[model samples]
Each structure stands twice: as C-alpha cells, then as structure tokens.
Target: MSTFLSALAGGALIGTSAALLLILNGRIAGISGITAGAVMPLSRDTPWRWAFLAGLLLGPVLYRLAFGAWPVVQLDAPWSLVVLGGLLVGYGTRLGGGCTSGHGVCGLARLSPRSIAAVATFMAAAAGTVFLVRHGGW
Candidate 1:
C-alpha cells in the first residue's frame, strides 16, 4: 500500500508536469532537449529551461536533506561511470531525435510510428546490454 501510494504520487507529479509543459510551452518536458537548450540556449530564451533543469538537479539534494535518505536503494558505481552513462544517454537521445519521455510518453501517446520504432529499439538495446552485462560478461 505504501509503495503503491508512492508510485501513484510519482506518476501524478510526472503527468502534471507533462501536461503543464504541453499546455504552457507546446513542448514536451524532455530532459535531453531541455539540457541541450540550457547548454546552448536560444538567445534570450533560457530561464524556464534552466529553472526546470535546476529543479531536476536539486530535487534529490532537497530530498536527501528533507528525508535524510532517498527512497530508493543506492548504487556504489563510480562517479566517472555515471558521468559517462549520462553523456552516452545524451548522445543517444540526440541520435534518436528525443529522449524516453518524448518518445515513450508524448510520441507514443500521439501514435507516432517513428517513436514506436525508436522505443522498440531502445528497449531491445537495453535488454541486450543487461544480458551481456549479467550473463555474457563481454
């Protein structure tokens, strides 16, 4: 019951943000695009994006301070690995023309064929990577 409630709350928050972004900006709240814009912003067009990204970056810090611990289990992976993974994900998002939220939620909801294919490919790649890491060890 607690877990379900927590998940429901999280989902509601995500849906609300998505709806708000669509309504306010006619844009999907896709992190990749948001981060890119912040890094290489359009002239005089950056505050909202920066604020959004800042919230995302600061949310966990606030959570840690508020709760004394994050809800999820922690991983001991190297910081370099995590940074590399983020970079790779950013690159992949560009290659795929959007990130998971854009393609998986917004695009699929809109019945986009390209998003369907892109998401399928992303899933397959993720599965394959996990398999290789866990079993193949190659």
Candidate 2:
C-alpha cells in the first residue's frame, strides 16, 4: 500500500474504534485515562480498561503476525530522553485533561470547544518543539 493509503486506513480505523467505543460503552477512547484507570482503580470499570491497554500493546505484534513482518519504528533520541519525553507527555495529558486521541479525535468529533482549544495548543507546541529541535540548539 502507498503511504497515503496506509495512513488513511489507519486513521479510518482509529476513528471507527473511537466511535464504537463511544457508542457501545458511552466512554471516550482516551488512552491516558484508560491506562491510569487500569493502574489505579476507581470503580468497576477495570476489566475493559485492561483489555483496551492489552490491545494497544498487542496491536503491533498482531499486525506482524498477520503480515509476516514487524512494523518499522525509528527512535532517534537516547533512551533517557525517550523515557523523559514519555513521562512529560503523561504528565501533560493529566494536566490538559486528555491525550491527543481523546481531544483530537473523539472530543473534536463531538464538536467540543475545549477540544478545539486543546488541539490548537497541542499543534502549536508541537510545531514550536520541532522548530527548536531542527533549527535551534536544544
């Protein structure tokens, strides 16, 4: 498949899954919230959270099994930097009320003003980070 087609398919799958989650479970498909709930239970919603997290972890492996090749992933940063980045992102998701999938996909689909603002902020921050990384010495 061409890159565009593959990306379109991936996006369609993501949107469909998010829609299905909302329709069937009456829950937003927020990965960060799901992960946190899985780690620390607040109610009786633990099982589905665990299942969702497991699917996320196993998606690539299943794809590899079906395709006979692992998906390509490129990591240019050091392990320490990667870990730090992940930690920062986790923190940011909590602070901002949702992750990209939640705000950018599900929330936006619901025509939420908060999600629009969050997405705009996320995009600006990402653009600035890329600029600083590529042009300015970090």
Candidate 3:
C-alpha cells in the first residue's frame, strides 16, 4: 500500500545517504561522532567537520520544506528526562566506542566484531526498554 511504499522509499533514501557519506567522505554518518568531532575537533580537522555537522542540523528543515511534513515522534517524558536520555546516549556512545550508525551500518557492513557486539547490545537494550515502558513492567 501507500504506507509500505513510503517506508521503502524512506529506507532506500537513508541507505543511499549512508552509502554516499561513507564512500565520498570516508566517514560513517554517525550524528554523535560527527557532533563530537565538530565540538572538539583537532587542530587540523575542523572546517569540514563543522560543515558536515551543519548539513546534519539543516537536513530535516530542508526535508520538511520539500515534503510539507516532518516525521512526528511524541514522547510522554518531560524535557528534563529527554535531556537526561541524550546525556546517557552520549555516554554510552563513548563507552561503546561508537554510535549506532557507525557500528550498525558502516562497521557491521565491514564485518567488525566490535561493531557487531555494539549493535546487538543496542538492539537488546532498546527492545528491553520498550517492553518495560509499554507492556512488561515499568
């Protein structure tokens, strides 16, 4: 149906972007890694990192303008909780050595054991959290 077609198109777009970023930039399109590099860039690698980060920041705005609608994700949690969750994600990224895109997309495609483990752990934790919050026990 229309929804399935839309989802397929969206996924294909994501995969294309990921592939292009990896092949052209020789970098994984991991938001956390990109943000970190931009914020705490080394002496020689700041401009391109900043530009990449800016592209990421502006991408959704451009998408909304072109599509006339933005994806909606509503959370019941307060702003403080959301901020706390972000901090936790950043911390976990450092602990795991990479974010989801870096590990799941680029790394797993390259057959890295660390990336495989990281992605698996991420899936298990995410599934458990959703179960606890939605159905199991919260």
Query: Of the candidates shown, which would achieve the greatest lDDT relative to the real structure?
Result: 2
> What overall lDDT goes with each candidate model?
0.83, 0.90, 0.81
Clashing pairs in 2: none
Query: Model 3 segments beyond 4 Å from truth?
Result: none
Winner on TM-score between 2 and 3 is 2
Sorting all predicted structures by TM-score, with the top scorer first, yields 2, 3, 1
Could you give candidate 1's per-residue lDDT for residues 26-51 as a string of tens digits?
88887777888889976777898999
List clash counts for every candidate, in order.
0, 0, 0
User: How many steric overlaps does candidate 3 have?
Assistant: 0
* Model 3 pairs whose backbones collide: none
Model 1 TM-score, 2 decimals: 0.80
TM-score of each: 0.80, 0.94, 0.83
Model 3 lDDT vs. the true structure? 0.81
Q: Taking the tens digit of each residue's C-alpha lDDT, what string does model 3 give over 19-125?
A: 99878877777767877777887567667778877777787798799888886767899798799889989989977878877887678878999899899999999
Off by over 4 Å in 2: none
Stronger candidate by lDDT (1 vs 2): 2
